[model samples]
Target: MITKYKLYFLTLVVSLLLLGCASKQNFIDKSKSITKETYTYHTFENKNKLQLDFYQSINYKNTKPLILYVHGGGFSGGARDENYIKNYCSKMAKNGFAVASISYRLTMKKLGFGCNTEASLKKEAFIKASEDISYATKYLIDNKKKFNIDTTKIILVGSSAGAEAILNLAYVYENKILAKEFKYAGVIAMAGAITSIEKISTKRAIPTLLFHGTKDKLVPYNVAPHHYCKKNKKGYLQLYGSKAIANKLKELNTSYNLYTIQNGNHSWNSKPMFVYFREMISFIDHQVLQSKYQQKEVVKKISDYTSTDL
Candidate 1:
């Protein structure tokens, strides 16, 4: 026995809920329509092989932006073909970008060692992963004509351990001679961190988008030893999380966006992939594709400031 006004209010609430559901379902349908192409991108001398799976929209009209996605599994497990990753990449592809999901060497075999050995192995793994990503990027750029990739619009997206790798790839490895031919458009790190803030220099900084749950235990939301190992532990690798890296970027006057998920955990991919994907696409559109920050301008500013002070 509801009043007419009460019944009207209830009807409006139900209508909104139904509309929300319809919208979400439409998004899912759009993601499902993207087409994918797979290729073996690289192989190592050790017989370890890495591959890339590319996703693009059927209606893509021009050279598409590139998203090189790295999967996460504690630097040990995970593959480029993981359904969640594939689906996420497909969704991004549907949004008019070419998404490449890549596989890299993992180091779970050497995990049980004491602190020093563990830390050393972890460091080696990070380096290897970063190197692999560099190779993957090179592979794409070298064959951009075949893949229809816009070389100037490459983005790195990684999750957890993969996140760590891409952050190092973007900030650490890019600073080296090995990446001389590479130019990153932006980096998106999900539950990721870096070995040191010192690795990130003002001149080498790129637009960054970060997503971290404050309660992430494995990867610190702030700063901590890799895997949250105790300070006195033998294998403790110092790592700086999104907040720390963002602060450093702020000091350098670099463009960066940090989204801190309240009470969020490390299993971000477990949630509906599109939720974050939408935000990520927005970041890419605004920060990378439409960004006003240019490499030449940054270098010029640094040069001018140095001369003025001198």
Candidate 2:
């Protein structure tokens, strides 16, 4: 009992919905085809072990980019094989990239990571984590030919404490542990910061994608003390977070993207992997793999954000 034009409009809407569903189903099928391989990459002098969970597509080609991911646990406790991380890595793999999620030493596991924890200990934690990442990178580079991956396209992705480690290594700290000529292709830091913002110079400026919440209580969106500790506290260490780092990169005229979440909390550490996957992939393709100079800042309020949408 409908007019011809009204029926035509209805048919078009139904076709569009079906097309969307078909596309989503295709993505799911591709995601299911990812393969994961585990490797014991390093062993400490104390006989402690570390491992890497390498994820790739079943039909992965040669010279594909690699994403090295570090999990967040405040230098206390976090596993590389967590379900969320696995899912995230799987998605990246489905996109024709190799992903390596690594395990590092939890130096602060025994001594809690709190205001009572000394700043020196916090610094040591960052150094230790970065060292582990360096070793992991070296292992991948050494076997790049075997894995058929392009070592030059290796990007670092981390959350919270892990983000701090990667950012610190990318800028503030020198990698005396790795080969002198080696450098990470880019960095994706989620709620991350660095110990010294001044250390990030033109030479160290790489393609960077920063995701941070303005209301992040642990890591500051700008310059602030670690864990918001007071000046007299033992763990009072100043950190330059995402906003500060992005501003530095802007001053240096480097390629960077800062996605600021207004009133968003530290939970954004994992949300980007799920919600902003396209942005991450775009950065890898345009900024890291190619020479794309984009200094973009996206600010979204919490009320406007939902898990289902990009």
Candidate 1: which stretches are off by over 4 Å? Answer: 1-33, 110-117, 174-181, 269-273, 293-310
lDDT per residue, candidate 2, 112-229, as tens digits?
7788999999999999998899989999989998777888778999999889999988997778778898888999999999899888899889999999999999999999998899
Which window of 10 residues has the lowest lDDT sum in candidate 2? 16-25
Reference-based lDDT, residue 309, model 1: 27
- Where does model 2 exceed 4 Å of error? 1-30, 307-310
lDDT of 1 at 253: 85
**Candidate 2: C-alpha lDDT:** 0.85
Q: How many clashes does each candidate structure show, in the order listed? A: 2, 0
Best-fitting candidate, scored by TM-score: 2
- The residue-level lDDT of candidate 2 at 111 comes to 88
Write one digit per residue (lDDT tens) for candidate 1, span 1-310. Answer: 9753345335434533443443433544645558777887787788777788888876665677799999888776878887667667765665567889998877654574235456878777888889888888888988999888889889988988889999988787644534465579899888898887887887788899887777777788888876678778877888899888888888888888877666666764334245555556556766787775522111112123232221
